[model samples]
Target: MQHIGIAKLGKRTKSLVKRLKAGDIAIIDHVDLDRVTAESLIDAGVEVVINASSFISGRYPNIGPLLMASEGIYLIDAVEEDVFNQIKEGDEIVVRGDKIFHKGKVLASGKTLTVPIIKEKMEEAKKNIGAELEKFATNTLYYMQKEKDLLLEGMKVPESSVNFNGRHTLIVVRGHHYKADLKILRSYIKEVRPILIGVDGGADALLQEGYKPDIIVGDMDSVSDEALNSGAELIVHAYKDGSAPGLERLKKMNLPSKLFNALGTSEDIAMILAYEKGADLIVAVGTHANLVEFLDKGRAGMASTFLVRLKIGEKLVDAKGVSKLYQSRAKISHLIILVFAAFTTTITIIMSSTTIRGILRLIILKIRLYWGF
Candidate 1:
């Protein structure tokens, strides 16, 4: 198949997705492409994806390549690095099979990804997944040992204007199935009215779903300016050394924010902030839970997540994928109550109406006459 489109190149897939438009060719150097990036690419409506690095490194069966393949997106894998230097943004590029062309000159070539090829690579990756798991577990234990005390002893949170005391809090992260999770929680959100917290790009997710986040926590790189300025309390996650890269952007934007210098991911800090602020129940949406999820996030270990969950204990509720397992079915008790209420309302209506009472008395008198009672 032959297709032509404008080339949009970036070393970072996440950053590139923002500028990408439909029918644009996305040139990225993403290795072992994660699901989130693939989803972003798919959402951006790119016509083709050219990667300098391997999409499936045979590491642990990353589902990103498979996801892209399934979506029928043309993927060129393991292309030469010179492709980036040779191509400029907005240059009309042509993809004919495996070769990329710019103005009739061959810029680079790579293998075109197909469903069959991706499936084969996934099979190979799965075969060696045990080794990957061992390495992952070892890294997790190693880091957990060192990081446990900091998380367990309690973390120092920055002052926040939002109050979480005795109220349910919802922390949204732009992780796997986050959209579906949020969709399922619509009723709960309306009824419980939890304080909404969006982590980085998760703020955008909230906005897209017609939600206004009460708190926006992250590096502030992924979130849009509109979200940051949506009257939400901003909290910048910083390194242990007290350096915050995201703070500069907010400062430049003239947006006031509190700095929470801590270790671990931004999602971790968001949860910690709610816990420290005495939130009654903390509900998490689109959080990374399993090994593959952590790997997808490029996290080698779940040290911080494990410790944070432990410290938070039962107060934390992971609402990830709850939509798949359970639905809002009416319970037996609820159904019974509903039926009883309906019956009571019918009887009350009949008793309250004079015409209905007269008709009932006439029917009773006729029955008594017929029976000679």
Candidate 2:
């Protein structure tokens, strides 16, 4: 029931956990009810939440409202700064309609305030994002072509025999909000369990969540050595001319890896490899699937991804933005209880059964005799 100003809420979003740890109630301003922001706030253990800007206030399962209710946190929406100003930090504030009560004291009384129309603001943000995506796609396309040219050259050289069966394989490309996306794709992962592959920085992303990738495929830049040494097979994306700049780095780490002289990004090569290896399903996580996502990478064309998707057809599932739609925080308490129960049951059965007792006694006697004890 504490009253805090809107300014304090703005500051808490930047480092919510730190503020909560210091015993500050948070007021979140201008939240989109996006899953990522909601989960973050919940994880930070905020006691009460106040949303200044929420597009779908009570209609949808917005992250803010869902999290607030799930974590037993109080929620108040559509309040103005005037109401905020009337309340100070640590003041017990209660909300009943538009009235705010602070420790049984009336702070302010008014009808629910309406927010300014923000469709224009949203459109502006989308427009800016689109522009950035286009630039990224262009750059990505250029690099892909360059890499493709090099891969073509390497094909001319005699290389080790590689097996290919057209398997559906997924290569992850970790970008913004990738962690959230991964959480959403957890079910798909358990179901498909595709030959999990990581491309450059994506390998680190997998490692961050304790997922040991089946293969680490990339140009060797932006990936940590720990990821490279995670016991997964390594495939270096090299130019067609058979020169892989990343090979030296792997050698420096005393690691052994295969060179994939291909003309696409590491992700592209990974898909190609998986498809060629006869994978049944390809589930992508934190990878570019839409135009904006591809453009964000500065690629001119998502030719590789497009072709791979087409080739994979119904087997391909893009997991980008999936987290925004779903939320799951797995609790292992039941699993822990099951394990403990199983162990206790086994102990009880062994101790109570005459046959088991005789077997144990014989085994102990044999052990003692063997040791001359």
Best by TM-score: 1
Clashes of 2: 40
TM match of model 2 to true structure: 0.47
Evaluated with lDDT, which candidate comes out highest?
1
RMSD in Å for all candidates: 6.3, 12.8
Q: For model 2, state the Cα shift of residue 247 in Å.
A: 1.3
Give the least accurate 10-residue stretch of model 2, judged by summed lDDT. 151-160
Give each model a TM-score: 0.87, 0.47
lDDT of 2 at 313: 73
Name every residue pair that clashes in candidate 1: none
Tens-place lDDT digits, model 1, residues 1-373: 9999999999978888999999999999988999888999999998899999999999888899888889889999999788889899899999999999988999899999999999999999999889989999999999898788656586779998888899999999999889889999999999999999999999999999999999999999889889999999999999988899999999999999999988788999999999999999999999888988898888899998998998899999999888888767888999999999999999999999999999999999999999999
Judge candidate 2 at residue 87 and give its lDDT: 65
lDDT of 1 at 174: 92
Q: Which stretches of candidate 2 lie over 4 Å from their true place?
A: 1-170, 187-192, 328-373
Candidate 2 per-residue lDDT, tens place, 296-346, comes to 343456656655565557766777677777665566998898899999999
